[model samples]
Target: MINFINKFKGKSSMILRKSKPYRYLICILVFMTTYALLAMGLLPEKYSLEVAQVSPATIYAPRTVVDPYLTKLAEDEAVAAVPEVYNLEASITVAALSGLNQTYASLEEAAIEEDPQEQELLLQAIKENLSEEIEISHVRKFINLTSEQREYIYTNTYEILERNLSQGIKIESIDRAKNQVINELTLLTTDRDIRDLLIDINVPLVRANLLYSAEATERDRRQALNEVTEVKILKDTKIIDQGEVVTELHIRQLEALGLQETSSQDFGYYLGLALLIGIVFIIIGVYLNIYNQSILVDSHKLLLLGIIFCLTLLLSKAFSYFSAYLIPITLAPLLITILFDRNIALLLTIPLAIFSGIIVGNEFTYIILALTSGTVAVFSVRKVNQRSDLTRAGVIIAAANGLTLIALSLLTGSFQGATDFIKNISLDIIMGMVAALLSSILTIGILPFLESAFGVTTSIRLLELANPNNGALKRLLIETPGTYHHSIIVGNLAEAAAEEVGADPILARVGAYYHDIGKVSEPYYFIENQLGNENIHDSMKPLESSKIITNHAKEGVSIASKFGLPPVIIDLIQQHHGTTKIAYFYHKAKEQGEGEINESDFRYPGPKPQTKEAAIIMLADSVEAAVRSLKQPTKDKINDIISTIIEDKIQDGQLDQCDLTLADIKKIKEKFAKVLLGIFHQRIQYPQK
Candidate 1:
């Protein structure tokens, strides 16, 4: 048993060593728990219902489902309403014309024959070739007619066939069409024999041109069936009234909604829901892996993210029991934006809103409301300077929520009466406002704890530390006023440089404000705080002066720690000087004939600047002190000094640790030059002097 426990512990330790597997385990746990929570609320409730019995209680649909029987009935009605279609062949008319012309041409050929035997033979052939309705006697009479009379009969016959057959004839209209052709010929020709011959020739030629098309008819029926809208039973709609007798319709509806005792558990629904949530998780995971891999690889950040996701899901589920509109949908996004970045917050809001929608029975209006309000909350707190700013952000989120609810209400028009409509709108507004306010209130209460628990510093805390009233800054201001003033100039320079290089300006500025807190311990020992040019360092050995100067960085870390400054700010305080040699003391020691002076003894211990903000503060701190030391700090002199300081730092390899590119360095140079010029620019002498 001891060996088994040790083996399990060993395996657990191995799994935790690899961040990806650990992260995956956390994700799996979150996904399973999230699925369980959603299923608890969303799974259908089974009822023991029967026909002609009073319902024990009213039941609402857990999800939208189509009434298959009602939809089938509607589709059948739609198909029955569709008219049967027929197609005109058009070839039937052409065939009729061809047959009539052949008969007329044969008769004409026989009429042109002068030999009585040949003419009789031709008439016999034409009669045999004709339809059974056309007799040889009619053909012989047609052959016996004068050529002009024959031409007139042929023209009348052709006209009759063309007119009757061109109009589409259905199977029922064929006889009427034949009689009409016969009547037209009778009115056109007075001779009985000619009319009878033309009747026989044209009547048989008029076939039914319009034919029933089964394919077209079936296509129309299928279209009508497709057009039949399904009868959908909405979620949360009362399926049966309490104390009402259960009927066959109620039983069927219950079965359709999987609410009947006989209805088996819908594994497919559970599978579909799981797959949908899996897709949302995949989207968030893929985004983090692609654009923000550091978060995915960091155990603490990943744990925080998973916790936030699950917490939001649980809160949304719990709140949905009251009203979906009252869910604090902005909470996750607001926390994420403050803890991480805006891009992650925006992308993550999509899945969070989708989860909110699911918790509320998939209300799409709630999804829209959540996304709109969450996005507004993100932008509002993008740069939190104070705790009250969060309250202000809450007010903005409330306004966004109220506006979004009003727009959705207007679009859905779910109101039934004027008084109810007003009441519903007012309730929505109040709930939406409460939800927004609740998110803000929760964020404020939870922020400090999360910061302490996670060991992360937010912008709001940085801003607070930057306040002159803070213990560290206040001590530096009172004990080392000159250093305090110098630190302010460094902050201005650092902020401008940081902004130009796309680094966090607030962090750079705040870090600068506390970078020299150790100087407060020995205010008069520093040159800037000395009275006139009284040199305290002149009386001390060059090595001792260097030691005193280098000790401030270490002392600043201790001071900042005592003051409870963040690790990142402490890092800035420690790394501002990097490992660069203190040139003044080393040069002084060498010129004073101090034998074989070692340069390493005069250097400050450092881990270098590990981030762009740290690097900027270093440069800003150096440039501010160097430019202030120049007696004639003109524009040209300040520009030259700033460039020289940057170049020296670059050559000394102080910037090697940070990710500052050459382009960023150039922008920093320009910004430093511009700011220093503004500070050291000339002022006109007074006329009274």
Candidate 2:
């Protein structure tokens, strides 16, 4: 496994270095394509309905979706419950009375005609004109009446029309009012023609009294449905029964939800999905540019984050086939938070949740649950100090996942009955706990592999190296006790000062511990291990001694690699003195009247400190050795020495590469002063008390 990882890592490194310029664009396009494809799978073809077609199979909600048509149907039913309105036409009755009087006058005129056929003809003409205004039967009766009788008939017909038209009547019930007018006229006069005339005139005159209020009815319906405050079809709810013949209503519900599978795919639908994916990719890219530029530019970090994202999404897609709650959504964040910082892990959380939701279905519930749970996972392990802390973090993460699941379930009101509520809640709680545990388990199992593959340093790996039983540290302790003790003091000073500067203290400390491992090869040649009068370096030429000192850094790198120590610690071994000249050896060589002494030959070959932790260790290593040489060092002396050491490093351009600020330098000096004081403080002698 280790060899395979090394080969894979080597290949990846070559490709990344070669393609550095277009790495960001490549990552974005790859992830965007993946997410778009996942969305395409979940999204249905543009919804369409075929009349009288049986559904191929039962269809369920791919995710929680609203049924707008169902909501509208409910609102329409509320509007239909309101009663119909009828409005009476007062003008109809007025016009009818005027026509009746005009008909009576014409009949009176006809009675005087001497020709009997002409008189009948004139009466018939009057009746025909009146028929347009009132009813045919009533006009005919008035036409034959004597002058005095016709007057009563006209007055009676006008009164009955007024009575019927005075009140509101539905358009459908206009005939009932006509019948009422007939009954009324019959009682007033014994003539059959009079009653029939009343029926024709009043019925024709009656208009719709109440009108249907279209606007008011719609407003009331909206108010009613707006108060309903619930989704028609919630998440995990079934849409249709298996083997049941599809109905028109079923197609309507499915079409409203955009879950209906049509015969052909929609171009517009895919276009919308591609556009949305582009937006999300833009969001991720912008965030990385603004807050995590290192990860944005470094191809290795980008690949690691992208790989984790794709892994989580693929798993979420697989688990969605079973149930939403079963997805181990928190795993990526946990792994990232442990291997990287909380900020980067938190940033990745949003995309992880979003892509997981897309792969599962278009469901926000999964996103919500994943984000909340992953936040807990990130924060819980933020300050991990021991191996047990990861497990403890797992338990807390599980509790948080379960609580978030319950809260979201309550808000959506997805429960149908007590049995359903209990069963589902239990399953959700169990699955949520499983997701958190799986995050811990997977992170624990996969962290070492990732660290080795990417050459990434995590606090867990640092803590392991800090142990006395560690291979490289143990070898130093047994082979060269003096170098081991020197390395331990360097580790303490580096860790304290790095903390003050807000750098990685564990990385600083762990790097310091392995920095002097090369001295194990020739322990007595160094003064720290030469506790007796004999000094191997005193008899040697200054040139040879300087060569021995410079060679230790190279030798340390060789030894460190042999022991399988991380690359970060080996960098400290090489960069601790940087390219600074060996001042003691150079002056001694000049005093001996040598032909020439080159400063570069005595300097350790170095790339200098490239990170804040490595830079802190370099300063701390010099300060520890110089402070220990002081004769009963006081707090004031320690402070001056630490400040002078920092100034010299600045003047020599040793601190140029690292990111430590002026403010950070002052804090590192103060920490060095405090730590040195503890080591060199005077212990007062006292008489036996």
Q: What is the C-alpha lDDT profile of model 2 across 1-689, one tens digit per residue?
A: 98689679768776785576668566875667565547757665443445566555667765565677676666667656654433345565567656656655675677567787887788667556445645544554555667677667667766776666666556677778767766777776676666555554445555555456667666666676677544477765676676566676677667655666652334555676677767877787898789878877777677777777777777787787888778888888887887767887887788778777777675788889888987888899988767678788889989998888888878999887888788879888898898788778877887889888777878888899898898888988988888788888989999998888888888899999998888887778787788898878788889999999888888898888778888788888888888877888888888997887788888888878888888888898889888988988888889998999889999989889889899999899888888889988988989897
Cα-based TM-score, every candidate: 0.75, 0.72
Instruction: Give RMSD to native, each candidate.
Output: 6.8, 8.0
Q: State residue 522's C-alpha deviation in candidate 2, in Å.
A: 3.6
The lDDT per prediction is: 0.86, 0.77
Candidate topping lDDT = 1
State in Å the error of residue 372, model 1.
Answer: 2.0
Clashing pairs in 1: none
Q: Per-residue lDDT of 373-430 in model 1, one digit per residue for the tens?
A: 9899889997887889889999999999988888888899977778867887989889
lDDT, model 2 = 0.77
